[model samples]
Target: MPSITVRNVPDEVHRALKVLAAQHGRSAEAEIRDILENAVKPKGRKKLGSLLAEIGRRAKLTDEDLKTIEQVRDKTPAKPMTFE
Candidate 1:
């Protein structure tokens, strides 16, 4: 394993990191390692736009079908929601 040093971090950031580490029941160093690992890792879930594009490709929707769907969607009125 390799070691790295991060110098001159702001006081507030250090304080916040310490607080977060305590909340997660770990030392600041462990919390930072976890944070770094998560930041570098790819997310498991696909983004909405990517999923929609894939679905459209699989469905083989034509330009005319898309135009008609857009027209219908634009003309439809939105339903109101009631909260008790």
Candidate 2:
């Protein structure tokens, strides 16, 4: 196994990572390894996080807003969109 050293990480970011690592029952290094793996790897066609990020990046909506939109979408009547 190879090793990589990361330096100059801000204390705030490090503290957040420590909290998240504790919450997820993982070591800080393990949490960082996961972050790096997901950050570096592309999913299906594009990177996984980027796809979700872009959906929100394009739409200026919050979780509650998205939930409301989804509820409305689910309640709306669907008409046949095909043109004869």
Candidate 3:
């Protein structure tokens, strides 16, 4: 697990966070973690895979079509980039 240190938070903001955490029945640290998680990765956010799947559904793609695409896809490993 990765850890981060939030430096120099204002006193009022810290107090507010503690109050909010108490209301939510969690510790201040847990509340801060939840706040950060939601801020970065909110509910109802559509990921790329989900979006692509939705598009495929909307286009009415079938299993056979997927198999055909899989069979025809390039299998070669990509060349690594070189900088001069």
Best by lDDT, which number? Answer: 3
For 20-75, candidate 2 gives per-residue lDDT tens digits of 99999999999999999989887866777989889896887688998887887866
Cα lDDT for residue 54, candidate 1: 90
Q: Pairing residues by index, what is the TM-score of model 2?
A: 0.50
lDDT of 3 by residue, 25-62 (tens): 99999999999998989679889999999999999999
TM-score for each candidate, following the candidate numbering: 0.52, 0.50, 0.66
Clashes of each: 0, 0, 0
Q: Which stretches in model 2 have alpha-carbon errors above 4 Å?
A: 45-84
Q: Model 3, stretches more than 4 Å misplaced?
A: 1-16, 19-25, 40-43
What is the per-residue lDDT of model 1 for residues 3-81, given as tens digits with 9 covering 90 to 100? 8799999999999999999999999999999999999988997899999989988999988988988887866578999
**Selected candidate, larger lDDT, 2 vs 3:** 3
User: What's the true lDDT of residue 10 in model 1?
Assistant: 100
**The CA-based lDDT of model 1 is what?**
0.93
